[model samples]
Target: MDKQAALHHFKEHHFTPLLESELDKLEAKFHRCQAGLISDFKQSFRDLCAYILSMQQQGLKEPIGYIHYSFLRTQMLEQSYLYMVEAYSAEWYEDDSDCKLTYDASWAYAPMSAMLENLEQQRKIYMGAINSADVERLILESAPFFHSFVDSLVRLAIAESVQSPEYQAIHKAERLLIRTGEYRDISENLYVWDQEPLRADEVFEQLMQSSEEEPYVYENLKSLSLPHLHQFQKDLRYNDFSYSDLRGSQFHTCILLGTRWQQANVEGGSFQGCLLSDTDFRYCHLKGVNFSEASGRVDRENGLRTPGLCGIRFEHANLDEADFTNVHSFEHAYFEGASMQGTRVPRIYQQHWKLSDSQRESIVWTE
Candidate 1:
């Protein structure tokens, strides 16, 4: 097909429209997740406290003042109505704070997990049955908020006498709580609110970082929605950029090796002089982009090896003026549709290439 005909076909058949549609759905779910998640956490914390207090009433020392969700999955988190909790494990360890407790994926709650799953659907799962969302990193950054919430709740339970349903406020104006209303023993999860309501929007912002500033050193930027982001010579290697909407973003000489760009919209972006060895770009948009001097391959010398691109698929992508002279994988890279026009690849690729007649006609050999 001619260039115009092929481009028209690609535009009509591209799957980007489906991905963009999902963004709206995810945003709505995110708002729901924030408020509901916090409330559920408060209830879980209060339930744990009541369980400890019951043991103390029976002349047994409270094992631990922990709202440990992983442990509670066998107890209050077990879909109980009266805080009749049990234990997942008979052990507790020291938390990040002075509290003798443990921590798992705080986002392991049902609402937050659904939000994360839909956000990065193609993520690979290694540790568990489910694909782990940048959960570890999210928990790390929001450590202050979690620790404060835990410590304050523990202090309230320890100081106050667990006798009846009525809560005696130390400071009425500063106390923030959510009551279970099911049991008098399980009254509330207390915290010093400082007269401010929980900022749900602020919590959600951690996942969808804005383009105004650079990301953290180890931040997981998978399924990002920031567009027109501008940067220079950044080290963003070994990150997941799959399903990202980074269209028109500029990266002058950035290191993006082993980065995933599957189905990411990077149209009109600039990646001049970038190191993209072992980078996956199959099914990504690259319409009218500048990628000059980008090394997709490297030479191994004195037994020192460097990562190189092996197979790439420009699946109906617009590869306008992309020069792959030094790209060793240029021979193995697949190109179809509009990507066929004027793509400059090494002459060596043509001599030793194993592509059939139809595939060979799509490529242009260069010195």
Candidate 2:
């Protein structure tokens, strides 16, 4: 169609609304067209490109008074842009380089510059994904960028998890814990490289020695071998650790969903403000573990869940009025406001409780 005719048709058909209605379709079509740049699809590409440019030019600001959501679309658009470029690279033909490229036929940069920009963006996203919400999606979108991005994410996650407001008190309260002193049981050479303990100064020294702060260095140390690192690819997703010993470790506000802690010794550990849903702590030792503010020790007026035993083992431990809901065990467990539902404890421990048969059945074999 001629330009005048096309313009007339656009106006006549309510083009802007039509385009907006099919924005997703247009996006897909443009992505496919840009990849291959087939001659027949050029017009469709041009129209779509024009619409995006027009929208950008109109300066669409976010909703009124939202600090967080303003940055929300940034990550989404970034992810879309990455996929778009990757598609462009896969379908780009050399002969088309001489001609200006367009999805909507509006003028954009040259093909070479576009490719360069894509590479630059890929690098920037690789670096930024360390502390980004789109880290998971970005990792999935660009598997090639994994080596650079993964470690940064893992370290950042670890660092964030281990640093919380309750860290100081928890750490101080946990000093009475005696180390097994088994001398490095984990096969991953956790003690091999420089063997620097992860104190603040030590970590700072290591970080300063490197020009850039890359989190992968910690990942490498955690896994020592390529095979182990590869295992981490799947394992890292849910922090998938089952029947593991995570004792004396400090975890801050971290994600620990779907992790297995069966029969594990997490003694003297601190898990402040961390998400621990769907985690299995069956038969695990939680002695002297400071679950501060997490165990419902605070009063009900504080609007917190009441302490109820849940899926946790508390053998020979002191849980002074800490919250315990849906906990696993209270076998031989000691506490003040903490008693048992299905807890199998000694008669002396439950001397305070007047239990019915069903409530009594919750405990298997109490002392």
Candidate 3:
């Protein structure tokens, strides 16, 4: 489908009205506080949290829902901080001296604190499934609001001398959100290699010139042997690297989605923090390969329902510190002679696969 048509489909079918409804509710609550109709800040905060959770649960049911919900959640969080900054007065902080804000003789700090934590937890859960372009779009859409919100918060905190624990926590949360957005941008733009063929000497020159900050793309390099190469943080997605010798290659934080490494020799390669979801590594030599913090799982229940590590091989491989969280049918993958020391395999594998005692001992359960 064309780009416009695809976008329309997404907005119509996947993006639900429920998101906008919840956002409207939250905004109305904030407006009510501004009008001084709500004296109990804690009750308003509780209602805001309830709306956020309701939106999150709806997103958990589908991929498109999750994307829309994520964007709206960020906006709501910023709004919540804005409301708190506006509701409490400078005299309120000075009078307490204990950094606690109260309304109607009740502490009003716990709900806001809990809301920030819940937002972060949800972000982490859905991050791996999020598309790179979607992340960029969300960041762009929310940039203006986020900037203004932070500016206002900083000004308010300085004006009121609000160095309370709650203020500090909000500051930290804002910083984390900004940092995570930067990381997402970096991850999205890490692959930029030409798709042309060249002589062996030319290829070697390109590889040598590449660095982790500016990674070279080998997406079109098929059936070629590239052993002991330092192609760290490269974008090798949707390529056919089948029958290639890629032993000891550095692929840290690389994107390898839908890439074919079938029957390839990838021994001792480091794929730390790499995106390997839907990647085909069938019959490949993964001996001593490190997949630490690498994600190969699809959102099966909500998205495409793709199987993780399907038909992949780990014959005599070192899987130390590898994480297989949310991986589907991972037990179906071949693991003959593989070392799973310190590996974080998913619980689904244990219940489905009849693993040997030695194999069980090698793996560490996440739960």
Which segments of candidate 1 are over 4 A away from where they belong? 1-219, 297-306, 309-338, 346-348, 352-359
**Candidate structures ordered by lDDT, highest first:** 1, 3, 2
lDDT of 2 by residue, 1-367 (tens): 5545544443334323332233334333433443233332233333333433343345431111100000111233233212111001112222122112222211111221233334334434333422322223332332221111211122212222223332211211111111111112211111111222234344334433432223223221221111111111111212323234555655444434334344555555655444444343444555545443222121112111112112122332332222333222232122322223444334443454444454445544333
TM-scores for candidates 1 onward, in order: 0.37, 0.23, 0.36
Q: Candidate 3, residues 133-252: lDDT per residue as tens digits?
A: 543353234333332222222211221222233322221110111111121132121111222343445665766676545555424454576887665666656455666778888777
Please give the lDDT score at residue 86 for candidate 2.
Answer: 7
CA deviation > 4 Å runs, candidate 2: 1-237, 293-367
Give the per-residue lDDT of model 1 (tens digit) for 1-367.
5544533343333222323333334333433463454455445545545544554456453333323222232222332212222221123232222222232323422332333344344323222322232433332222222222222223223212222232231212232232211222323332122234323344235423422245322223546676887766666664556567889988777777656566788888877777776565766787657776676664333211234312344555666555565553444355544454555656777765455565456556777
lDDT (Cα atoms) of all candidates against the true structure:
0.44, 0.29, 0.43
168 Cα displacement, candidate 1 (Å) = 46
lDDT at position 144, candidate 3: 32
Q: Which residue pairs show collisions in model 1?
A: none
Clashes of each: 0, 28, 2
